[model samples]
Target chain A: MIKALEDDLSQTFNIHFKNHDLLDEAFTQASYVNEHPHQGLKFYERIEFLGDAVLQIVVSEYLFKRYPEMPQGKLTRLRAAMVCEASFSDFAKECRFDRYIRLGKGEEKSGARQRPSLLCDIFESFIGALYLDQGRDAVERFVRIVIFPKLDEGRFDHIIDHKSELQELLQKNGDVEIDYELISEEGPENDLTFTVSVIADNQKLATGTGHSKKVAEQNAANMALQKMRGK
Target chain B: MIKALEDDLSQTFNIHFKNHDLLDEAFTQASYVNEHPHQGLKFYERIEFLGDAVLQIVVSEYLFKRYPEMPQGKLTRLRAAMVCEASFSDFAKECRFDRYIRLGKGEEKSGARQRPSLLCDIFESFIGALYLDQGRDAVERFVRIVIFPKLDEGRFDHIIDHKSELQELLQKNGDVEIDYELISEEGPENDLTFTVSVIADNQKLATGTGHSKKVAEQNAANMALQKMRGK
Candidate 1:
């Protein structure tokens, strides 16, 4: 089972593990270790710990360079949104990690492989194993290929509610007044499109149109955030 | 004031900052920014954020390589002990970071410079600045010169209570009975030393002596931990 999964991972990811044991250990659940006492199989907890640190640094470095002008708070928030458990689970699903997980009979019956937290842990453990077997370059390459495309797809954009993010960003500058005003309404009431404008310090920052007033306000806030971020 | 501190830091640390502003920002408090609004000075929060991730990765990498046999949980605990507020404050004081810190009149009057939290923030921010001005290698070098030596000095050893650490370690490997037995007492009652032996699974692992029974037990646990850690 371990060899088959290792082969699948290599074929699917286009990366070969020098130490197959590391790869196997990355997928091995704690429950599996509990059942196989004499097998001396190690769980993925340690690798997960290391991989978490690696992921943090890699993402931080990427954000630090990509957004040179972004404040540290915003950069930190962005990194958090990108690497949070939900995001990791999504990445794991995309990589078909569920298919390769090694669990005990109990955990298998309980459907532990489909768990988001477990999947996230496995994802991080895999990165840890890859780092150990290959190197930083290989780990970075893996992240870039498997994860960076999500950035382009704006998968994490929804994680940060633009309205709240904009508000927080504005608050950091001082007690600045921020107002989203309804500018116009188009079409009939049932299918109306609302235009909203975001004003920071009485200056019109940006405007957007949406199907509803709330969405229009959010879109306006998103536009304002982009403007403030100098994007 | 900033220039003088910058010179002192450069001289003491043997590090030349190409972008001196980054270094200055690392020590600039938010209160200082409030006082010098027209000066457009940046605070250390953002740099501290980046520096924090850098520090974690550097320390994690160091430990991962240094103790190949150490379990991940222990490694995590060791990293936490090393990077905790107390440790960072100690590092900051050793570098005389208080002298370089830019504080508002209010904070200065209140003796905020000597505060541990502020010192830790500055220490992390300094790393951030160093990473930005130079690179990972330079940041790692700084940590190695200033922080790694402390590990050799046994400065962080006391941070983890040996008894609890040992219990946690033993619990990870399944259920095991740990017993601490008082072996002997020496000297008069008022100034007596107690010797204790730690037994795991009825096997005496190590013995320790201390002035009090609790201390003796702790010392015995520490000895047991060392033996188990293969030190």
Candidate 2:
């Protein structure tokens, strides 16, 4: 078995897997193990479980420090988005983990190589292997290079933006026009309350009141999103 | 501010908090912060978030190393049972965290002192504080003392036993009779299979086939559990 990582893995990420067995296991699939049972090969799922915890702690600490005043509930939602299958698969692709996936012939033909869940699992197992090889600091450094840049670029900012969330949800089933209409303005100028209605695909879904137009629109979108979830 | 832990914390657990703020925050309830607005007291939720991740990695690593043959799905379920509100709260109580709980007058009057969720949060925040003060090894040592002994005592074994799980689920809403019957046996002596049916509260729940009567009963209970979850 080709158990050792390529030189680029060390040169790019400063990671040296002293344990070749773990490195091999990280790239191995369960199907591959089952197919070649006599080869004494191992799968990545066990390491993925460990790597998930490593990722969880790293993300949790990063968020805790980044947003000192933020509440736990919002931090949790943001963490979920960061470690989600879509995000992890993208990270795996960026790290070229897909190129190293070891699969049984059946799995390879079935296109398991390009599957998001498989990609996510391989990435996590890679992380798990890295954690075991070099401990949490090495894993943190790896994440700093691969994941933090995205967070710094505000890729995860949409997690807190209900308006963006509403747009994304509606846009999932193809493009749809989303309109925010200013329903009303009330009270004194200094203490004015704005009411906004969110209309998606010609349907007025929800109306919300807030201190500012942006806030009101966000609230409206929030209500609309909640309604959709309730169904 | 009483921002320091008693010497017993160090004596019993060998934990010394250099950052007394994190330690103080761990023991401070959210309600206390809400009530004492001018005092600048912080709640434990943020630290609890960090602590939860710290706890997760520790537990994950522990389980991974202990059970090399266990699958990820089973490992995940076992981890959940270990860190659940009921289990964590029990750990907190055993560590005498209840004596250190800081609550507002209203919360104290409402009996928040004995609440399991509150206990769990404090335990987690305490762990988070320890991680920040020390690091993963210290946190691991803490869990080794607090959580591992219970596991070694087979306290968490119930998590993997479907029969125990089904019994607990059925027993949740008071007592209910549960029975397992050997429905059939088939095939040659060396390749024989047993079919068992599980009945709960006089209603036939599910049937499963396995190599042995015990295995078949467990499989039946597993099916019943799945059906209950689906409903």
Candidate 3:
């Protein structure tokens, strides 16, 4: 499993870790360490701590250089939106990190591998391990390849909490009626999906789908905002 | 004034900026920009923003690597203590940054350069300017020379809120009577200085002096705690 995951990571990232143990530790959870005490594997917490700092600096530098005219307050908000849990989880899902996470029997039984927070931590841990094995340039390259493209493509727009933003934008021209309507619902009750459409001034602006109504509404609002901004 | 300040900074940091404008911007407050509208000098806010992130990653990486066995929580607390406003202000004062800050006449009259918040911002701004003028290696070296030695000497001991820390330490060995007494007061009412003594179980442990009673008490507690730890 480790070898297969390593190959996948290498193929995906176009980079390989010299110290395979760092890569191994990136996927190993604390619960897994408890069950495999003799294996001498470290958990992901420390690596996640380091990775969190690395991510902050890399993203902050990128934003600072990219937006020369942007105010500090906006840069801070943009950085927060970019590196929040949802964005990290999305990146993890795109990389198929859930397939590589090592969990104890109990944790595996509880489906902890599919958890968003766990995925986020593993993503950060992977960055940390990559940083230690390679260097800042490699880690920055990885971020550039995996994360910056997504930023350019507007993949993480939903993290911006755009409903309030859209309302605020519309409110500039006096009071305007903004609404999100459930357009469709599907799948089982436990895993139901929702599609919502955002309307402003009786015009259907945009539509989006998500696992929950609120998320769908937010996505729809975000799409509407992006279109409004002509992005 | 700018040329003299630049020479002073060059001597202080032992590194010269290729672009002297970055150094000028670092010390240029918003009020200064307001007064010198035709000078095309930018304020320190944006630079401070970048420097803040740079400082965080540098300090965090140092702590993470230095204390391999330290927990993430403790690392976070230590980083906060190291980079807090008070610590940055102290660093600024040590470099005599207040002597070089450019402020409008109103701010100068109000002693804005001596303000802790302003000092902290200027310190971070100086780092940002340094990072831009040089590179990461130069910025890291600057931090090593100027800041890391202080960590070794425990200059930021007061950042831990030593009064509470001392109380917690004493409380661990059952209840202990910890008292702070005003040992002496000097200067006039408007510019008075206070001397405080920390007494534990009727034994005077340490004494400290500050401009305010609260600061004097905290300094006294910090000194006592340091004595207890033999640091």
Candidate 4:
């Protein structure tokens, strides 16, 4: 069973772990170890701790070089979004890495096999195991193949998180209260178009229309960001 | 002047950088770059971001292997202390790496050179430079010589209950990883004797037998303390 797992994993990862024990440890969940303590198997959490850091550096270096003129604050925010649980979990599923996790009967019954957090940890632990077995170059090669393409496609830029960007810009010098209010709503209950206007320090900025209030506010924020970028 | 800086750094760190630009960037403070924008010379902030993550992963893996049985929370706390601003800044000054920092005229007037935060950032940036130029093995060797000695000297922050004193002693000035595990349980249900062992930095320090689990842990900690006093 484990041999088949290794075969499939190597095909997907484009590399084989020299130390198979580390690879097994990376996929083993704590719940599994708890259920089978006598097996003397380790779990992924500690390796996940290390891999989280590895991902951090790899992403940081990539961003630092990719956007050379970008400021440190912006780089930090982009890196956070790129390495976030949502991002890695999505990448894990995309790579079919989710098929290999070894959960205990309890966790399996609880339907934890598909949990985002678990998937994220597995992704990180796999990186850790790869780093230990194959070194950083191999890890970089894996990421360049698996993650950088998605990154280059701007898939992670919803990270642009416009509302927060607006808040950060407005609050750059001092604390300023920003509010968004639904200025208008039209059409039927099932298909209403809401308009939202953003106001900062009692000064109105921009208004935008969307299918929902949240979407309308985001659009409004986007308009304000465009203004900031231009004016 | 930059060449002299590199020579001095190579002497202290015992590794020469192949990419002098990165080495310069590592030591180049942001204030200095702002004063000389056309120099096309970058500052430490971006690389510092990478270095900070490198430091985190290196320290994390070190703790993970050193205290194989320690829990994640304690490992995290210990890593934080080791990599915190207070800790690295002292290391930077100890290596006299602070002497090489090039400050802007304004920053020099304000005496920013001796700032602990600045020194901390330099320490991290230097690590970043080393990792990029010489690779992880060289970075690990650098840490083994420069940082690990100070760590072994018991000099950072401090922490004990029976668990905590065994912890405090093992931890000394800084926090260390400690774990307690049940080794044995024997005899009839009502007359069962529980044996617990205390582990400090992944080594079994002592074990004790008692009627109750808590009593066994307390006795185990006490015995560990006695052994420490003797040795």
Candidate 5:
């Protein structure tokens, strides 16, 4: 079964697993390992760690060069938006990467293998395995081939417009209504500070204080934006 | 004058500069270029860009292996905290890096060279120039010699207490009250969601959010923590 999955993943990722056990370990969720530790299998969390870093480096470099004039803070926000789990899950599903994930009887019965989060993890672990098997340059090449295409196709300018982008996201996701509240105003009349809180439905998401109400709103919006983006 | 500066720098940084122009450019503030065309200099912003990525790669690789069990998010935060302009300024000042910066008559009168921000830029730009002149390994060695000594001396628990460190900084800096406010919450009741804004001294410093209010507050604190850590 492991060999067959390796063959299947090799076709999808276009890289053969030298030691097939790497793939086995990646697919073997901690639940399964806890159930049967004698299998000598580990979970993909370590690989996930490595792969996350690799993804950040690759994506950050791409965005840095792509938007050379952009300041560091914006670049950070953009990278966060692009490599977020939701986007990664979308990419993973598009590539049908979930089919290769190994699942225990319980997870398999519950259809946990098809989860976007699980798919994203397995995809990251796959990159980690590729790095181990083929090295950094090889992993970079694979990532560029697999991931950059989607990022390139994306309307990145929309990402820079944080408010509209976030509004669209909340609407599409059926998220609760997010409202901005003017929580406080302080300081001298000439240079007053405005404190704004972004409240989603009845709960507050983030509060921001700025020299002006607009800036405070934007700050609050940006924070709320990132929160949903991380989803 | 250049030779004297170089000797002083060499004694401090333990690295010899084969190209004095690179060193001069590294230490040249934008104000310097406003006068003295024969100073033949450029500002350090471009070099800061190059150095930022170079630092990220080096630190990422180092942290990846140093704490084999650390998560990617933690490594990222640690690297950001370590490589920020504020930290660079502190290190550079400790080595008298600001003293070497050349300024135009006007800037010299204003003490532009002594400004922490300018000093930090020169230090980072110097690292970029070193990477260009000597390559990654050499630059890495130079960084280790100049800065990591003090960082290494900290207790093991320092790695895990970014918020506490920031709080200590606030205490030392004096009279700054920091608070985090929940701005918004989204998603379903069962899963929930939250965003938080961090206010420092009645000014919004940063905002972050996660699955729970605690996580959101921590995230906001962490962002502010990163912002405060470098210098």
Candidate 6:
């Protein structure tokens, strides 16, 4: 399966991998590693990390100039909607990542490969592999041609607006007024640091810091979000 | 000035500002109030808010389909860079927002229009005004025609990767033990909340919450990024 995948991808991406382990890692779930450590199924966490940034820059540049009259906030929201986990999961499903994913016996039986979490991670890892194998151009072209078109046609299909999600999280199940507070400041006056605390009923729900107060608040709000996910 | 400005804009946008106040507000800086209490210059905050969402959705939809193979992480960073205050300021300047801005005597003397913060706000306000006047179509067209082109050009520009910045921040700050921890949980068994803390030197440097632990940690790590900027 590894050889077949490398053969299939090599022609498309125009790159050859010296080590099959890289591609194998991209398709290997963490569950697989826990089950068979001797199988050497490395997880794709590192690749996901690299791939995440690659996608951000490419998509951002596309949007920044694509909508010249757009204000910053709208652009930010749009980007979030387009690039979230649900969307990634959908894309991964379209690519049939579940079929190729090397899952642990438990995961395979439980259909964990189709889970949004694993799917999104594997998709990101695949992107990271492409980037590592052939650099930004190969990765960019593959993304633009394969992934983006699917996302555009299905913009609202699996999209989650972070602000809307955060707002809902604050309103639901929590017995407090969720407020974002700027807790600290640092850096030069031109570029400042803002530490924001997501407080529910005056107790800190979560706190995050960012370059701007809004960003810090958003981070804290997102923390508050995870604190209230399924509830 | 209102009529002349309207004439000039109408030539390009084919849109008219029914109330000149909206136009004025789009260009006004809060600093206008400092010098002239009676000078009734409405600041750009409201318009900035509206424009922010408009810009986001437009860019998001465009990007979602434009780059199909790119991973979520890279897409996010790119969007941030494009929608950041600095880029908005640049866009506002390119649009000559300063020349049209209605400033009080003090702000005018202080070159408030040229100020990045004020310009960024005004840029948002302009989008807000467009949205209020013409709905999404008008705003969308303006974004597609004006804003996106600039971003398209930025495709050639190098992007700053935030996650890598996180790693560098830890290394530079000499925090060998910097890592993310799961702090709390919420939600049902199907979906969960994960609160993550970024710790260094056995102290919580920052905490972020998200629907998933990965997102929570990313949010936390990004928040921790404030400590590294300009350092």
Cα RMSD (Å) per model? 6.0, 16.0, 10.8, 12.4, 22.4, 23.8
Query: iRMS values in order, in angstroms?
Result: 1.5, 0.9, 0.9, 1.3, 3.9, 10.2
CAPRI grade of model 4:
acceptable
The per-model lDDT (C-alpha) reads 0.84, 0.85, 0.84, 0.80, 0.69, 0.68
Q: How well is each residue in A27-118 modelled by candidate 6, as lDDT tens digits?
A: 87778789886764567765676666566655655555443334455666666766678877887777666678887798788878678988
TM-score-wise, the better of 4 and 6 is 4
* Per-model chain A TM: 0.70, 0.68, 0.68, 0.68, 0.63, 0.61
Best by TM-score: 1
Q: In candidate 4, residue B212 scores what lDDT? A: 82
Q: Look at candidate 5 and tell me the lDDT of residue A165.
A: 45
Return the clash pairs for model 4, or none: B160-B164
Q: How many residue pairs in model 1 have overlapping backbones?
A: 0
**TM-score values for chain B across all models:** 0.70, 0.67, 0.68, 0.68, 0.63, 0.62
Candidate 3 TM-score, C-alpha based: 0.68
* Candidate 5 wrong stretches, greater than 4 Å: A1-5, A19-29, A63-78, A102-123, A151-154, A159-231, B1-43, B46-50, B69-87, B100-129, B132-134, B147-152, B160-231
lDDT of 4 by residue, B28-124 (tens): 8888999997788788987788788888878877767655555666677778788899989988998787888878999888878899999999999
lDDT of 2 by residue, B63-166 (tens): 89765556788899999999889999999999989888889999999989899999999999999988988887888888889998786354764567778768
- Candidate 1 docks at the CAPRI level of medium
DockQ, all candidates in order: 0.55, 0.61, 0.52, 0.43, 0.09, 0.02
Against the true structure, what is each candidate's TM-score? 0.74, 0.68, 0.68, 0.66, 0.53, 0.38
For residues A30-117, what per-residue lDDT tens digits would candidate 2 score against the true structure? 9999999888888999999999999999989997876555678888899999988999999999988888888999999999999999
What does candidate 3's lDDT look like per residue over A1-231, in tens digits? 779888997788778889999889888899999998777678888888889888988998987876565567777888898887888988888888889898999999998988889999999988988888998899899889878877545564544456876887788558999989998999998999999999988999999888999888877876887687676
Error of 1 at A69 (Å): 4.1
Judge candidate 2 at residue B217 and give its lDDT.
84
Tell me, per candidate, how large a share of the native contacts it keeps: 0.67, 0.95, 0.64, 0.56, 0.10, 0.00
| Candidate 6 chain A weakest lDDT stretch, 10 residues | A151-160
Score residue A160 of candidate 1 by CA lDDT. Answer: 46
- Judge candidate 2 against the unseen true structure and give its global Cα lDDT, from 0 to 1: 0.85
